[model samples]
Target: MPKNRYRNKEVKFFVTGHEMEMIDKKAAIAELDRSKYLRKMALEGYIIKQDFSQVEQLVYEVNKIGNNINQVARRANEVEYVSLDDIKYLKKQLEGIYGQIEKFYDGG
Candidate 1:
């Protein structure tokens, strides 16, 4: 009654206690379970792990900038005037964003 069963074969193996501990550590780092980690290692012989916390923070900063810009635009529309200080503030925010992007790409 199964629609798809691509992985129908099972391979069983055994390892020592220290080897299991190392496998558990690596699986934790990769955010995968032991079975998936073993399958990936067996199939590809390697695993690539990446941290995106900085990128997530960058996205949060960009969202805050967008909100600030929207507020400035709304205020300008209401008063029909944009001040020099507002322009300077927006320019500074943009520069900060650019600096973050640069740092991210440069691996800093």
Candidate 2:
């Protein structure tokens, strides 16, 4: 990055193809084009040009994992006699991991 890259205050980041696919998938899931979604996030500072040094990023990852587990549970519930108990157990395990993630930010 050049010293002047931040002069205009908007910088371009080059992501790998695999990372681009993830961004595309997220944009599709959010029902917006990538640029539009990114602009909205930047304006709201939800995905913006702030520093992460003060906060733990794993908390964000844990929240995302919790969301994924909920989605999986929803899908599991749609099936008949497919070990809901085991699914519940798995969700608990994810929650445990989530707890650890939170603990990382909790001064532990």
Candidate 3:
């Protein structure tokens, strides 16, 4: 075992069955043991819950844009020409998607 460096003080508490269940659920989601999770919360006062649904949605939107771009490319290849307005519209759509991603990063 490694030597302990900090103080040896201890704290104890009790909670109802419902509370313990909630604790277990939270710890499971964080993929942390109960003791470590509780210690982190006690020290940090709160935990930022992980939620990736927004990221998934963003990826979905990007995939849709890619599909649209592919279709436009296929049409242009078949016809051997692409209009200036179509190109400009595609550029504007890409810029709007970029702005949406920026807003997500900025937490706006």
Candidate 4:
């Protein structure tokens, strides 16, 4: 911890056990001690809360698409057969993922 150059004020608050646990978790993720984390959050006037469910779902879909492509490739290698429909479907899926990512970044 660095010495506070202008230590002239103090702030205090009370929180329940659950709230404290949440604070600890957030602070840990932010790589800051609890007091510093709270001070930065208080002064910054904004906090970013991420919902990763959509991202996780997107990753899952991408993985599935990749697996399908792999299977298609293996089949193509075994026999000289490749489906244009599957390639088109993969393109559409990728486009959908791109749109979803754009929406997410746009605060949808």
lDDT of 1 by residue, 2-72 (tens): 54868878798899999999999999999999999999999989667998999999999999999999999
- The RMSD of every model to the true structure, in order and in angstroms, is 12.8, 14.4, 9.5, 8.5
TM-scores for the candidates? 0.62, 0.33, 0.54, 0.54
Residue lDDT tens for model 3, 1-108: 335947456778999999999999999999999988888889986668977777887888788889878988998999988888878878887898898789889886
In candidate 1, stretches whose alpha carbon ends up further than 4 angstroms from where it belongs are: 1-44
> Which sections of candidate 4 miss by over 4 Å?
1-47
Which digits, one per residue and each the tens of the lDDT, describe model 4 over residues 23-72?
99999999999999999999885867988988887788788878978988
Per-residue lDDT over 1-108 for candidate 2, one digit per residue giving the tens place of the 0 to 100 score: 477653445648899999899989988998999987777666764534855543556656567777766767687678743476767766786777767767766756
Q: Is candidate 1 or candidate 4 better by TM-score?
A: 1
- The candidate, 1 or 2, that scores higher on TM-score is 1
Model 2 has a clash total of 0
lDDT, model 3, position 38 = 89
Candidates in descending lDDT order: 1, 4, 3, 2
**Residue 75, model 2: Cα distance from true site in angstroms:** 48
Error at 25, model 3, angstroms: 23
